[model samples]
Target: MASGSIKKEANGTWMFVVDIKDETGKRKQKRRRGFKSRKEAQAELTKLLNDVNDGTYIEPVKTTLGEYMLTWLDSKHDNMSRLTIDSYRSYIKNHVAPSIGHVALSKLSPLDIQKLVTDLRSKKDHKGRSLSASTIQRIFNIVVTSLNNAKKMQLIKENVAKLIDKPKIKKKKIEVWDVDEIRVFLDGMYDNRHYICFHLALLTGMRQGEILGLSWKNIDYEKKLIHVTQTLSHDRKEINHGAKSHAGVRSISINEKDVAELKRHAHRIEEEKEKAGEELYEDRGLVVCTNIGRPVFADTIGKMFRKYYRKFNVTPIRFHDLRHTHASLLLKQGVHPKIVSERLGHSSVTITLDTYSHLLPNMQEEAASGLGNLIFSDPQKNEL
Candidate 1:
């Protein structure tokens, strides 16, 4: 059974001590002082004894929020992706640490988190722009995840964040180009330097990094297939092997025309490599690169697209919408959504359907119309 005792401290304050056995069957004592009355000490002691009996007791700890968050991040290092780890570190270092690093982990409250969220929402960056709703939400999520882990570890009895409301996120409209718009854009790109990149993006739905990370080795000309095994990191300084989820590492079928275009692009790369000579040739073996054989940066590619878009006077669209454009065009052509999801490397078909649900009504109407025509039409009556 748990037991407690009250004693007068040398500092002339009442102290309470509760002794109990821990989960490991070892006896331990929790002591707290500075109460002015025996009644006050007894009240706290009673709470501790009840907690010990209920198996909900956690030993007092001096761990600060900053300390716990850093340790939590370190524990996640091996399981998380490099990009994710980096992002977490940035948020912790730049935001969480600066704001509430000194707050004791056990002492943190829902109001403290709410205040942090409010401050983050109002906080301006070096550019004098307020924090975006998404950024603030992400920070809140990180803290909540950290606190949740703490709760799971029995460091705290409750996750205060659960009591607060999550910031509302504004849904973004998915933008896509129609077939006619794509045709106009591509037709204006004849003999353009980055034609292969744009063409592969629209036709294959390959991401920018995947397109930039492509190598001759990833393609099988005879099989008319392309493999996505790696991607250029957003920073454009390193190749992230097995970059996305396992689903992202997939092989997509290409048309013969696309394969022919790829071969031409390969040949052009060879000529450029030769022109650069042995000394200047970086020999990275990437399918897309600069004149000097260096890996082409993603920003440079985006800027190139933007420049061409302005010059051609086509509808203004971000380069990423090309992937959306490809999916949209295929859906309009009556292609199955599962196939589109696989080609786009989405983790699930549900994501594909959700993203393109707007287009589904038309397809459903067509299906209904076709079924009605088949069921209601009478060839014999029509002949008569």
Candidate 2:
């Protein structure tokens, strides 16, 4: 049996004190304060007693949101990528922890989360600019995920974060280079040292990490195929085995011209190795590396890319925009979306269509015109 009592407090509020026994049969008093009315306190007491009677009671603890989030992050370290984990930690330490970190995890409310989202929208980073909608949305997602986990662990009766609306994010227009622009850039950069890196990005739509992680063993010279098997981490400190997703592990076919370029690049590597000597040179069998066989940093590549595009007087776009340019060009050429999706290592064709939906209107018009020409053209007239 369970027993409890509710009474008015000296501060003109209501409090409840429940008599309960621990797992070891030791008697204890569970006290909760700050209810607005006696009825409210009574209702809470009734619920607590019912929970205990049904063996569903969870002992209350004073764990703060800050403390619990750190614990949650630590638990996820093994399952998440280092880049992802670092991003989450940055959000927690910089935005989340400083604001509502002192609040009790059990006491966190939907209103609190909503206010947090509102504040984040107005908040500025160290650069003194307002947080981007995407960034706010990410932080909101982290809070929702953390609270959901808390509910699963029985630390909270319900996930309060879910009761609130998620932050709305505005989609940014995708930037890509046109065919003429690509040709101009490539022709100018053809003799450059890092030309092959830019060439592979535009040709195969391989990610920067995938390009940097490419090994000699993954390339099939006779078949003219490149197999994506691994990626370098963003920090350039670790080589993470496997692709970003299951679909990311795929083979991309290359033309004979591409094979020739790669072979030329391989010869360049051999010349450098010979100059450095076997004792001084470290051979990790990487397709793209520094003179001493060290992995080239992603930032270094981005800087070089920016420098070349500027020197070529081409309209500026990020290195990643090169991958986008490849997909855009292929889609514009009437290649099926499924093929584009597979080549880009997207998880699904739907993602490919959604990403390039802006291009669909033109494609639709072209298809209609092509259909009309096919059905209405006179074969006899054409032969005459």
Candidate 3:
């Protein structure tokens, strides 16, 4: 039978000590202190004895939140990408570790997590601006995930992070350019060397990384399809040989005009290769590359895009906005959401719908008008 006793300490507090058998049948004393009264200590000791009898008692650990999180991150190295692991490490080292890393994992409470959220809201970056809602939410998610793992490992009785409310994230409005703006931008950038890069983004809804990672072999010229099989890391240091998600691995069909433009772009690359000579050109088979065939940095592309948009007097939009513009134009032209989702490599049509829900009202109005015309138009007019 499990047994425990409570004793009044000289410091005017109460303590409980219980003798129990561990999983290996070895006797050990579980001691807890800092109770305000003998009654309080007795109640806790009784619960401990019951837990020991039920085989639900967890051994107390002194592991701090910082230490456990570092161990957890190390465990994730083989399972996660280097970029993702780096991001998590930054959050732990820069934000989490500085704030509450010293707090013991066993003693972590919901209020502590809430305080972390509050501090993150008030914390400023190098630009003196507070952390964005999305970023704070991501950090909160990481904390919750780490605590959950601790609970699963039987290191903690509960996950305090789960008891607290998640950080609120306000969705930013999606910005896109209209068809006339697209035409104007294309007209002005036709002669630019990076024209094909932006064109593929707008035409295929391919991400900047996907476009930069594109190889000549991935394109089916006769079929007018571009297979998205790989992507470049944001820093341009690594070429990950797969899509961002399983659904991201898809084929996007291009128009005949786009195919012809791509062919012309390929011919230009061939000429550039000849001018650079065999030794000078490091042909990695990338569709878009520098004169020496090295991959262009993603940041450089963004800066160049920004410069051209300002020069052309078009409303400023980021490079990724080009993908949104592509999807928006297709949706406006009455393409099915499923088809758009497939082309954009979204995991599901629901995600596509949620992202483009703003366009639904206009689509509904058009549908209503088309329905009226179908029902009210004269038979003769229809025949003609």
Please state every model's RMSD to the true fold in angstroms.
3.2, 2.6, 2.1
Off by over 4 Å in 3: 367-384
> Which is superior by lDDT, 1 or 3?
3
Look at candidate 2 and give me any clashing residue pairs.
Answer: none
Every model's TM-score: 0.87, 0.91, 0.94
Off by over 4 Å in 2: 1-3, 19-28, 46-57, 368-384
Local accuracy of candidate 1 as per-residue lDDT tens digits, 1-384: 799999998888999887889778998887888999888999999988898888887876789888999899999977776778899998988888888778889888888888788778878999999988899999999999999999999899989888999987786777787777778888888577678999999999999989999887999988889999989887778887874777899998999889988888878888888898999989887888888888888899899899888887777889998998899889888898999999999999999988887855687788899999889999898789
Candidate 3 lDDT for residue 344: 94
- lDDT of each model, Cα atoms only? 0.87, 0.90, 0.90
Alpha carbon lDDT of residue 249, candidate 3? Answer: 94
Q: How accurate is candidate 3 locally (lDDT)?
A: 0.90
Report lDDT (Cα) of residue 168, candidate 3.
Answer: 85
The digit string of per-residue lDDT tens for model 2 on 122-199 reads 898789999999899999899889888988999988888889888888777788988888899989988876788999
The candidate maximizing TM-score is: 3
List pairs with backbone clashes in candidate 1: none
